[model samples]
Every structure is written in structure tokens, then in C-alpha cells.
Target chain A: MAEITLKSLAHSYSKNPAEPQDYAIREMNHVWHQGGAYALLGPSGCGKSTMLNIISGLLEPSNGEVLFDGKVVNSLPPEERNIAQVFQFPVIYDTMTVYDNLAFPLRNMKTPEARVHERVMEVADVLELTSQLKRKAKNLSADEKQKVSMGRGLVRDDVSAILFDEPLTVIDPQLKWKLRRKLKEIHHRFRITMVYVTHDQLEASTFADMIAVMYEGQVVQFGTPRELFETPNHTFVGYFIGSPGMNFLDVTVRDGKVFSGEAQLLVDNRVHDGIARATSDNVKLGIRPEFIEVHQEPVEDGMEVKVEHAQDLGTYSIVYASLGGISLKARVEEDQITPVDKAWLRFPSEKIGLYVDDYRVELPHE
Target chain B: MNKVYNNRAWWLILPMLLLVAFSAIIPLMTVVNYSVQDVFDAHTRFFTGTEWFVKMLNDPMLQGALLRQFAFSLTILAIEVPLGIGIALLMPKRGWQASVVLILVTMPLLIPWNVVGSIWQLFTRGDIGLMGWSLRELGYGYNITASPVDAWATIILMDVWHWTPLIALLCYSGLRSIPDAYYQAARIDRASKWSVFRYIQLPKLTNVLVIGVLLRFMHSFMIYAEPFVLTGGGPGSSTTFLSQSLTTMAIGQQDLGPSAAFSLIYFLIILLVTWVFYTAIMNMQKDDNKGA
Candidate 1:
């Protein structure tokens, strides 16, 4: 296993890129620690797959060096790099039997027959494809074909990492979860560096120990699921990570007071200093919907909000409301009494995050 | 439980039945009638009762033509299939070069069969053609009319030049349909170029190749126009294929009964061979499916 490092990696599909927007992957340096299960998570066209391809040597970075275990392998082809990649759709050899499909890589390297057989059988067992070992890959179901594709990667012992580019896209929902768990098990058992690329937050969080949430061709935040939920590094992450997402309100600081459409927010001294020190005119206040406390009557330092919609979501209802003409969502328990027209909303000081220019501004710890 | 038997759908097939009968069945019946009778004139005919069929089957001339037809078809297939696949493999996968190469390759296929024959005829003439003059300049006698080997080689080459593009075009479409992921996966697996072609490219090209082989076989088996024009089936019937022999008996001379018998046999042979080729390819697919 080897750590994958990108040093100022940037790629542009255009031949002569004049502006930063031309680059599919904007310049950045990042490290995927050896044996760590990490995900390059983002929306479509955000360049997660581009980064994965760069690490796998399927693509050479346009501007920077790609290092594997601290050695620059920028010019190396994928075959010479010893990295395995499972594609979005199932790509098993149609003519080969499942057994032979699993054994293909090892056979290409001329691995001994006995060792190939042992490894193939082990992977087949893990993937629950033992019964289909004799069957042609073309005849297997989509998920089984995907498993066979994954098994090809697992069978090779010398691979530095196994990269997945949305490998579950073609699989059924039930089989997707099972195969993901199987992949996680394989990662743990082998201790190989696995980089899963997906636009789905749930898939990334469940499959990767560290999810690198990407936005607009850059990694906005790299943290655990809980860390991303509690403390999103960028406004994009705050908007992307949770269901219904974090509610952001445009605010202006005047005489050490934060005003969002004339509704003054109660905050600690640190936030007040942060707002005052912020240089960008696009200053905003952010808070997760889960942290917003809603009450029928106004409390101390509470702001009134109009209740537009309250959806009953079985376990918890998402209450959509507007404070000072700005829309916000709050997740309330099923038994929580929601008012028809209005409610008092409180943004907890501890959870309140101040932002300037969509980037999180550091608030001094109280 | 009574079923509604709508007779209206049966009327819809009436037009199809009439077309098939007019185009196929009526002509076929007339040939069958001639095969069983010795016809001096349209109005004056005598029932022969398999006499023409027995005589024609025993004729050594027809047998030689049958054997030569097999050899020629097999030779052309042997040369064309592999050569076509090789040309397709060497072709550029994309860009303006690919488009230019596709247009150039498809040039020969656009020519009519008679025109293809006329083109090859002049191209292989010792006095006027570049190829024949070059061969003669190299101290070789390359006369299609005199040498059986030259006649065979020139006709085979002409057929290959004219038709290999069909195979190549089919294969090119087949190759293009294969996703780039297979190649990337092959690279990741460290597959050799030969392994990639054998396991990935060849397997994917099988469907198209089957079509190419069957079409080429059927087209080549009825080899009349090109050989008749280029060599005139000369060098003492060296390249006189089944169709030329049938034409000679049926149209050139007025031996209707024997020629009709020969025509039926020729049709049956083509049908049988095509069936065999199609069945073999299909059974191989079935094995891959493994009762899926």
C-alpha cells in the first residue's frame, strides 16, 4: 500500500487555458494516507474522477506532480503504476468465466497457477460469487458482474490502491448496499488504500472513513461524517452535507450588532468580533436546521418567523419557516407542537457560524 | 369459454402472401416444372422424371465448376476476413484521419459489381495496366486469359479489393461500439496488446463478423459477374464458377431441363452452407449464454 499525494495538481481540457475556470481540476495539494478509506465526493463534473484518474495514472496531471509513496510518477502509465480501478458501469470480460475474470490481472503478470487459483477462490467467496465461478461473465446479473470487476482488483496483490468511480451506479438499490459493505470488508481485510469517487454523500460517508467534499473543482472540506455535519469548512459543504442543508442568512455588522433583514441575531462576543473584522461585503450567518430551536411563543432574545410549511417525516418533521423574509428549515420531533402561522426561532450561539464570501470565517473559541 | 376468431387480421397478410408468391414461389415452381421435363418448346414438352437431374449430377464439367467454386469462395474468405480485420485494426480510431480513411475504404464498395469487374479487367491487362506491366517487367507472365494461376489470383485479388471493405466497415462499427473503459481496464490489468485484441476486441466483434462472414459467403458463392468479365471464365473453364456454368446451360445453350436441375442444386447448396454458418455462430453464442 502507498499514500497518494497531489502537489498543486490541476488539469484543463483546453489546450491553452487562460483563466482558472478552464481547469477541470483547480490547483490543489492533497494527500490520501496509506491504508485510509477516503472518498472524493462531489457533484457531477466537479473533477473527483479526474483526481482519481490522476492518482491511478490513467491521466497525467496538466500542471503538477502526482506522488505515490513520496516518488513522483507523473509520466507513468496506468499499467506501470500498479493501481486498480473499478469503473461506473460493470466492465467484466464478457467472454471469460467469472473465475477467469477474477484471475485475469494475476495471469497477465504471470502469477503462478496455484496462487491465482487460491486468490480467485478467496475473492469469489468474499463476493458470494462462488456459485457463478463457472458461469460466463456475460450471463451474470449486473451486480454480480460488478462484483467480478471488483474481484479483479482484489485478486492482485501488488496494487498500491483500488480506485472506484461510482461503481454502484448500475447496481440495484439492495445490492448496492451489500456490495458497498463487501468493498468495505475487502478494504479492511487487505488494508489497501481505497479511493471511492461519488456524488452521493450517503455512499461516501458510509464507504469512506474520511470524505473529501468537493465543490467547484476544489476540496472544500475533508473530515468524518460527524465533523462535516457539525462544522462544514465552506458554505458549500454546509449546504451540501445534510438533508435540507444548513440555512444561511445574509447579515451586516453595525456597531457590533449582526442584522439579518432588520432581525438582530443574539451571538457571543467572538462572532461579533469576527463580523466586525470581516472584510468582504458578502457577510453571512449560518446554522444547521437541527440546531435551530422553534417555539410557539417568543422567548428571551428570540426572533419571530412565519411558518410556511411543516412536513411530517415519520421520525421527525421538517418545519419550513421564514424569519425576516429569509427561508429556513428546522427538523422538529414528531410530537413537537408546530404553530400554524408563526413561531419564535433561536440560533444557538455555539452552533452559529459566521461566513464571508462563502468561506467559513474562524470565530475565536469562547 | 368461446374465443373471438377475428378473420380481419388474416386479410392483412393477403398482400404479403401475394407478393411472396409473385416474386418467389411462381418463379420457383416454373423452374421445378422445367427440371422434371424435357422441353423442346414452350408448348411441346415431355416429362423426363429425374432424367435431367441424374445426368447433370454425373456431368464432370459441373462437378469441376462446383469444386472450383468452393475453392475460390474459401480462398477469398481466408484472404478477406483476416485482411479486413487487420486493416480495420490499423485504421485510426478518431479524428479527420478516421473520416478520410473511412471514405477511401468505402470507395470500392460503392462501385456496382459489373463496374468492379470492368475496373479490375483493365487494371490486370498486361499491355495497358500498371499491375500487369509491373509483374511482366519483373519477368513474370501475368495473363488472366492464359494462366490458370494468374486467372485465379487476379480474380481473388479483385474480389478481395472490392469486398474486404464491407468486412472492415462492419468491424470498424463493431470496434467503435466498444467503450473506452475496456481498454483502460486492460491497461490496469496489464494486458498485452494481443490479449486485449483477443479477449476484448475480437469477442466484441463476433456479432458483426458473423454477419460479414455470412454475407461475404453468400455473395462470393454466386460469383459470376467479376470472373466472367475479367477472365471470361477462360483458361479452359479454370474460373468458370457454378453460376457461369448454370448461365451457359440455361441461357447460352437452350438446355432448360438440365440447367433447371443445376439451378435447384445450386440454390440448395447455398441455402445449406448459409444455414450451417449461421447455426455454428449461433450455437457458440448459446454456449456463452449457458442457458441464461
Candidate 2:
């Protein structure tokens, strides 16, 4: 495995760069350390795959350089870049036997026949496909075929990184869990640098050591899952990183005080001071669904809210409604029942996050 | 079993089955009737029970035509199958540009068959055709109209232009149906261009190529309009094929009985060959699709 660095990279589909905003992937800089597990997470059409392709040398950036271990490799083809990638669907050769499909890449590299056989056998063993080695690929189940695809990439130990682009999306739900755990096991054992791309928050948060949340062709935040969940650098990150996502409410602040609609909020002056510098006074308050507890009566530091709807999800309930004209959601215990008309909600100061213009206003711990 | 009654599906197939019987079965019955009888005055016909068939078996002209038919079918398939696959491999995969290129390539196939024959006839003519004129200018004697060598060249060239596009179109559809994931995986595997084609593209193309071969073979076996209009089985009948020979006997020479027998033999040959090709292709695909 080798470290990968992207230096001031920017790309656009147009020829002349058109305007200052005519970029599919905007300029930014980041480094992926060797043996680190990272993910590029985003919604559909958010340029995550484009960024992944650029890193794999499938597309050249209009203005920037890609360096592998401090050596420039922007001009190298994907093969020369020593990166292995798995696509959304299984892509093994239909006519070849399972053994042959795993052996193809090694054979192309002119690896010794004996060693190639050994490598393929080892991979098949790891994948639990030893019994099906002599069988043709077309007859296998979709999950089995995809396993062969993964085997093809992992057969070569010299490859610097293995890139996965929603590879588990086509897998059956039960198989997705098993394959993901297998991949994690493979990464832990091999210590290979891996970059996975997906729109699923759970997959990214669970698999990657660091998750890069992208929105509108730019990375909004890059941090550990806990960090992203607790202190999202941008409002988009808050909305994207959790189940049922995070609840957001607009609050206007003036004279070191926060106001949600007409109801005033009690926030520390130090927290208000950092937000005061960001110009836009239309501040946003963010809280995870888990943090906003639902109660029968308005508790201390709690706001009275109307419960619009309640979703039953076996163990917990999600109360969807608005608070002070802004939509917010609160997670409640499944056994507790709140009237559909109105309920009291609590937002603890420790769990409340403040943002200005979709970006978090970093708070002082004190 | 009695859950649903979809009688509307019956209405959909009634028209189709009636059309097939009217257009195909009735005419076939007529041929069968003619094959076993000797008609004196349409009403005074006598049952002749395999008499014409026996005579056709001894006819040297029918044998020659049959030989020529297989040879021409094989030659056309050899040229068109691989050429179609090669062109398909080079076709652009996406965008409006692909649509534009596809239309241009399919334009030849869309032309009327007789017109295509006439166009190629002029294009291969000794004095006026561009190919002939260019060949002569290059110090080679070429005259497809009266010379056997020229006649064969013209027929081969005409068949290639008219049919290669059909194969290419089929192959293009087959190639396009392949998902992008395959190519991406190939890239990651670092497969060479040849390995990608052999292990991926060619294996994937076998099913369609079987269709290409069968279709080309059947069409070339009965190919009449172009060669008949261009060569008229001339150049000492070197270009005479089965359908042309049948036409010569039935229409030109007015030998109705022999022609009827000859047509039955020709139809049987095509059916037998097609069955064999179909069986082989199906077996191979089944194995390929299930072996793993």
C-alpha cells in the first residue's frame, strides 16, 4: 500500500472552464495515508465517482496533480497506477472458469504460472469458492460472481490500493453485510490502502476510518464517524451522517442571544461570539435525532413542540413535526406514546450545535 | 389454476396464426400437391408419386447449383461475420455521436435490395464502374460483366457491401448490451486489448455471432435478385446459383415439374443446415451460461 495525494485538483466537462463555477469537481487538497481506510460519501450526481475515477487515473484533472507516495502519476493509466477497483455489478468473464477469472490479471502481468495458481487458490480459499473453481462463471449466483470479481482484484499483492464503487449495492441485503465484513477482514489482514465510494451513510460510517462527505461537487467535511456525527463542519454533513438524519432549526441571534421564531434560546455567549463573525445572522441549530428527547411536559431547556406524525420502527419512534416554524424531528422510545397534536421536546445545550450559512460555527468548549 | 382468465391474449394470437396459415401453409400445401403429380390439363392430373424427385436426383444441373449454393453461403459468412464483429468493436458506445454513426452505418442495409443490386452492378461494371475503372487505371484488366473472374469478384464485393452492415448492426446491439461494469473490471485487471476481446468481448459475442452466421447463410443461399440482375447466371453460368437455376428451369425453360422438385430439394437443404446451426449454437450457449 502507498499514500495518495491530490494537489489542487479541479475538473470540468467544458473546454475553456467557462465561468468560476463551471467545475464538476472543485479544487481542494487532501492526502490519503497508506493503509488507511477512507470513503467518499455523497448523493447521486455529487461527483464522488468522478473523484474516484480521477484518483484511479481514468480521467485527468484540468488543473492539478496526483501523487502516489510523493511521485507524480497524473499521466499514468489506471493499470500503471497500481489501483484495483470493483464496479457496481459483477464483471467476471462469463465464459471462463472461476479459476481462470481469478488467474486472468496475474496471467496478464506475466506472473509465473505456479505462483499464479498458488495466488488464485489462496484467494479462492479466502472467498470460500474453492469448490466452484472449475465451474464456468455464467452459471453462478450474482453474489458468487461478485466474489470472483473481488478475488480478481485482491489476487495481486503488489497493487497499492483497492477502490470500491458501490460494489455492494447490487448484492442481496443479507449478502451485503457478509461481503462488507469480509472486506473489512481482508483490509485488516492485508493492511492495504482502500477507498470506498457510496451514497449510503451506514456503509461509509461503518467501514471507513475517515469519511469524506461530499455535496455539490465539493467535500463538505472529512473526519471520523464520531466527529462527523458530533461536530459536523457543515450543515450538510449533519443531515447526511445519521439514520433519520439530524434535526435542523433556524434561529436568529442578536445581542449575544439566540431566537427561534419568537421563543428565545439560552446559549452561551462564547458560542454566540464565534457565530457572530460569519456575517449571515440566519443561524441554524443542529441536533441529532437521538439527542432531542420527547417528554410529556416542557422540561428545563426544552421547547414546547407539536407532534405532526409518529413513525413506529419496532424499538424507537421518530416524531416528525415543526418547532418555531422550522421542521425538526425527535427520537422517542417505542413504548412511549405522545398525542399527535402537541408534545414537549428537550434540546440539551451540550447536544445543540450552531451553524451560520450552512457551515458550523465552531464552539469554544468552555 | 382457475385464478385468472386472460382471453384477450387469445385475440392477440388469432390474427397472427391466421396470417401465417394464409401466407405460408396454403402455399406450402400447393407445392406438396405439385411435387407428387403430373398435371395434364389442371383437371386431368395423374398421381406421379416421387417420379419427378427421382428425375431431379439424376439432374447434373441441380447438383452443380447445390454445390455452388453451399460454396457461396460459406464464402459470404466467412467475410461478413468477422468484419461485422470488428466494426462493432470500433463503434462509439454513447451519445448523439453514436446515434449519428449508427445511422450512417445502417443506411446501406436500409436501401431496397434490387436497387442495391443495380447500384453495385454499375459500381462493378467494366467500362463505367468506379472500382473497375480504378482497377484498369492501376494496370489491371477487370470486367465483371463478361469475364468469370470479374463476375465472381463483383458478386463477392456486392454481397460484402450489402450484408456486412447487417452483421455489424447485430454485433453492435450485442456489444452495447454489455454493462460498463465489465470494462471497468477489465481495466482493474490490467487485461491487454487482446485479452479483453478474447476473454470478454468475443465470448460475450458468440450468441449474436451465431445469429449472424445463420442469417447470412440463409440469405446468401437464396440470394437471387442481385446476382440474377447483375450476372443473369452468365459468364458461361459460372455465377449460376441454386435459386437462379431453379428460376431458369421454372420461368426461363418452363420445366414446371422439374422446377417444383428442384425447389423442394433446395428448401430441404436450407432447413437441414439451419437446424444444425441452431442446435450447435443453442448447446454452446447453454454450456456457457450454466457451466460455472
Candidate 3:
């Protein structure tokens, strides 16, 4: 395993790279520690996959350097970089047997025949592909094909890192869970620097220890999955990293509390009013769906919202509600049978976030 | 009634069946008639009982033509298939550029076979044609009309130029159908360029290459026009192939009985050879699929 550092690495498909806005991936700096299971998480077109491709040497940055093990690999091809990548779809050699497909890379590298067979059988056993070893790959199902794709990547232990770009996209729902569990086990056993790229919050959270939240060509925040879920550093992150997503309500901050126009709420005394000094008076309050407690009565000093629709999804019910002429959503426990029209909403103050123009506010002191 | 009729759909095929019978059965009957009889005039014929077939069986011209046909087919196949695949491998994979390149490659296939022959005929002449002049300038004694080697090379070159595009286009289509994910998988496997081509690209191209081999083989075996125009069976009959021999028997010499007998033999050769090729390719494909 090896540590990868991206130093001011920027890229733009267009020549001249005329402006900061011209970059497909903007200037960024981060060191992915050795043996760390990290994820590049973002919406489509956010340059998360672009960054992964760059790290793998499939693409070169227009500027700066990508240092793997403290040596710049900007000029190296993906093979020279000694990294394995699993794509969104299974890419197997359909003309070869499944065993041969897994054995191909090792054979190409001229590994001893005995070792090649042993390594292939070992990985196949791990993936439960031993039964299909002699079977022609053309007749295998799609999920099986993807396992071969993965097995080919995992076969080479000399590779410093293994990267995956939404490798579960084509898997059947039942198989996807099993594969994810298998991948997590493999990562733990191998301790390779695995960088997984996905836009799914649940998959990212469950698979990756560190989730790097990306927005518009920038690494907005990189932290553990739980940290991202609990304290999202950006408005986009808060909204993106949840199933029903976070609810955002435009509010005005006054005194030591934030007001949702006459419905006042209090929070922990942190994030110095330096947030208010940011030149924008328009502030938005962000809260996870699970954090907002819904009640039947006026509930004395809680915010109010009109419930539009409630979706009962077995384990939990998500309520689509509106407040102050803006739509908001709240995910509550399945036990809460919320009525339509009127409901008392309590935004658990300590868990709430404030963003001015999509930028999150950081508390000055605890 | 419609559902019941679906089970008896051969009723809908009666006219087509009659059409096929009239075209195929009538000609076959006439050929058989000519093959076994002696004909002095269109209306006056006598049963000769395999007399022409016996004579055709021993004909030196038929033997030479068959040999020439095989040589021409093998030579053209060897030249065209690899050339076509190479060009395809080098062609761009996407965008308007790929379309433009496709059109350029398709241009040669669009040229009429007769026109292709005529064009090569003019282009291989001694005095003014660029090929002859260029070869002479380069100090090679080259004259396609008079030399068998020159004739053979010109025929091979002409066939390659005309038919290589077909193979390349088929290969290009096969290449394009490959998903990007496969390449990604190869990349992650840290596969080398040669390994990727050997294991991935070549295997993917096998089906298209088989199609190309069959097509080019059939077309080259029956080739008459280009070499006919360029060499005209001169230089003591070096460029003469089966079609020319068949035409010489039926039309030029007007030996109807002998021609009819020879035609059946020629048809059998092509049918047998094509069957062999088809069966061999299918067997290989099946084995590969099972092993894969």
C-alpha cells in the first residue's frame, strides 16, 4: 500500500484553462494515507470520478502533481502506477474461461504458472466463483461477470491501491448487498489503499471509512461517514448525504437564536457571529429528516409546518411538508402517524446547521 | 381463425415456393438435360448418357481453372483479412471523424465490380499507367498484361484494395460494440497493450474476422472481372480462373453439354469449400464458447 498526495492538481479539457471556472477539476490538495479506505462522494458531473481517474493515471492533470508514495505519477500510465480499477460495469474477457480471465493479468505479468493457479483459485474461492472457474465467461450472468472483473483487480497484491467507480451499478439488488459485504471484508483483510467512488449515500457510508464530499470541482469536506451524516460541512453535503435528504428553511438570524419568521429556535452557543459578518444576510437552516421532532399540538415554542404528504416506508415514514412558503421534508420513526394540514416541528437545535449562500458556518468555540 | 392460420403458415408461402421452384427447378432440369445429351440445335437434342460428363471429368482446362481459383482465393484472403483488421484497429473510435473514416472506407465497396475491373485495367497498362511507369522507373521488369507474377500481384493488389475495407468495416463495428467498461477492467488488471489486444481485442474480433474470411473467400474464388480486365487470360493463361473457363465453354466455344457438366462440378467445388469453411468456423466458435 502507498499514500497518494494530490498537490494543487487541476485539470480542464479545454486548452489554456482560461479561468478557475474552466477547470473540470479545480485546484485541490489532500493526502490519502496508506491503507485507508476512502470514498470520493458527490453528485454527477462533480469531478469526483475525474479525480479518481486522475489518481489512477487514466487521465493527467493540466497542472500540478499527483504523488504516489511521494513520487510524481503525472507521467505514468495506469499500469505503471500499479493500481487496479473496477469500472461501473463488469469488463471480463468473454472469450476466456472465468479462471483464465482472473488468471490473465498475473499471466501477463509472467508470474510462475503454479503461483498463478494458486492466486486465481484463492481469489475465486474468496468470491465463491470456484464452481464457475472452468465455465466460459460468455454464458455467465452479469453479476458473475462483475465478480470476475473484481477478482482480476484483487489478484495482483503488488498493486498499491484498488480503485472502484460505482462497481455495483449493474448488480441485482440481492447480489449488490452480498458484494458490498464481500468487498468490505476483502478491504479489511487486504488493507490496501482502496478508493471507492459512488454517488449513493448508503453505499458510500457503509463501504468507506472516510467520505470525501465533493461539490463543483472542489473537495468541500473529507471526513468519516458518521461525521458527514451528523455534521455536514456544506449545505449540499447535508442535503446530499441523507436518504430523504436534509430539510432547509430560509431564516433570519437575530440575537443568539435563528428565527424562521416569528417561529424562533435556539441552538448551542457556538459559531461566533463571524458567520453573520460574511456579507450575506440571507441564511438557511439545515436539519436532517430524523432530527426534526413532529408533534400534534402547538407544542408551545416549536416551529410550525403544513404537512403535505407522508410516505410510510415500512421502517420509517418521510413527511413532505411546507413551511414559510418553502417545501421541507422530515423523516420520522414509523410509529408516528402524522396528520395532514398542521403539525408542530421541533428542529433539535444542537444538531442543526446554518449555511449562508451554501457555505456552512463553523462555531468559534465549543 | 387468424390464430389457427398461424399454425399453418406454410399456406402463405405457396407463391414463394412456386417462384423458387420455377427459377431453380427449371434451370436445374435444363442443365441436367444438357449434361446428359448432345444438342445439335435448340430444338434437336439426343440423349448421350453422361458422355459430356466423362469428357469434362478429364478436361485439363477445368483442372487448371480449379487450381487457379483456389490460389487466387487463398492469396486474396491472406492479403485482405489482416489488412482490413489493421486499418480498422487504427481507425478512430468515435465522433464525426469515425463517420468520415467509415465513409472513406466504404467508398471502395460502393464502386461497381465491373467498374473496379475497368479502372484497374487502365491503371496497369505499360506506357502511361502510373503503376507500370513507376515500376519501370524503379528498375523492375513489370508488365501485368504479359507477366504471370505481375498479373497475379496486380490481381491480389486490386482485390485487397477493393475488399479490405469490408473486413475493416466489419472489424470496426465489432470494435465499437465493445463497452468502455471492459477496457477499464483491463486497465485495472494492469494489462499491457499486447496482452489487451491478444486477450481482449483479438478475441472480440474473432466473429467479425470469420465473417470477413467467408465473404472475401467466396468473392475472391469467383473473381473474374478485375483480373479478366487487367490480364485478359494472357501470358499463356496465368490469370485465367474458373468463371472465365466456364464462360469460355458455354458462350465463347458454345459447347453446351460440356459447359453444363462443368458448371455442376464448379458449383460443387464452391459449395463443398464454403461448407468446409463454415463448419470449421462454427466448430471453433462452439469450442471457444464452451471453454470461455
Docking class for model 2 is medium
Query: Global lDDT of each model?
Result: 0.90, 0.85, 0.84
- Indicate whether candidate 1 or candidate 3 has the larger DockQ: 1
Residue-level lDDT of model 2, residues B100-137, one tens digit each, is 98998898888877888788878776689898778898
The alpha-carbon deviation from the true structure for residue B147 of candidate 1, after best TM-score superposition, in angstroms, is 0.4
Q: For candidate 3 chain B, which ten residues in a row score worst on lDDT?
A: B283-292
Off by over 4 Å in 1: A262-269, B1-11, B288-292
Error of 2 at B151 (Å): 1.6
lDDT of 1 by residue, A306-338 (tens): 999999878898899987778889988777886
- Go through the candidates in order and give each one's DockQ: 0.56, 0.59, 0.50
Query: What's the lDDT for residue B91 in model 2?
Result: 88
Model 1 vs truth, CA RMSD:
2.1
Expressed as tens digits, the lDDT of each residue in B1-292 for candidate 1 is 9999998979999999999999999999999999999888869989999898899889999999999999999999999999999999999999999999999999999999888899988888899998898999999988888999999999999999999999999999999999988999999999999999999999999999999999999999998898888889989999999999999988999899999999998899999999999998877765453633
Give the DockQ ranking, best first. Answer: 2, 1, 3
TM-score between predicted and true chain B, model 1: 0.95
What interface RMSD does candidate 1 have? 2.3
Question: What is candidate 2's CA lDDT for residue B67?
Answer: 83
Error of 1 at B213 (Å): 0.7
True contacts kept of each: 0.62, 0.75, 0.62
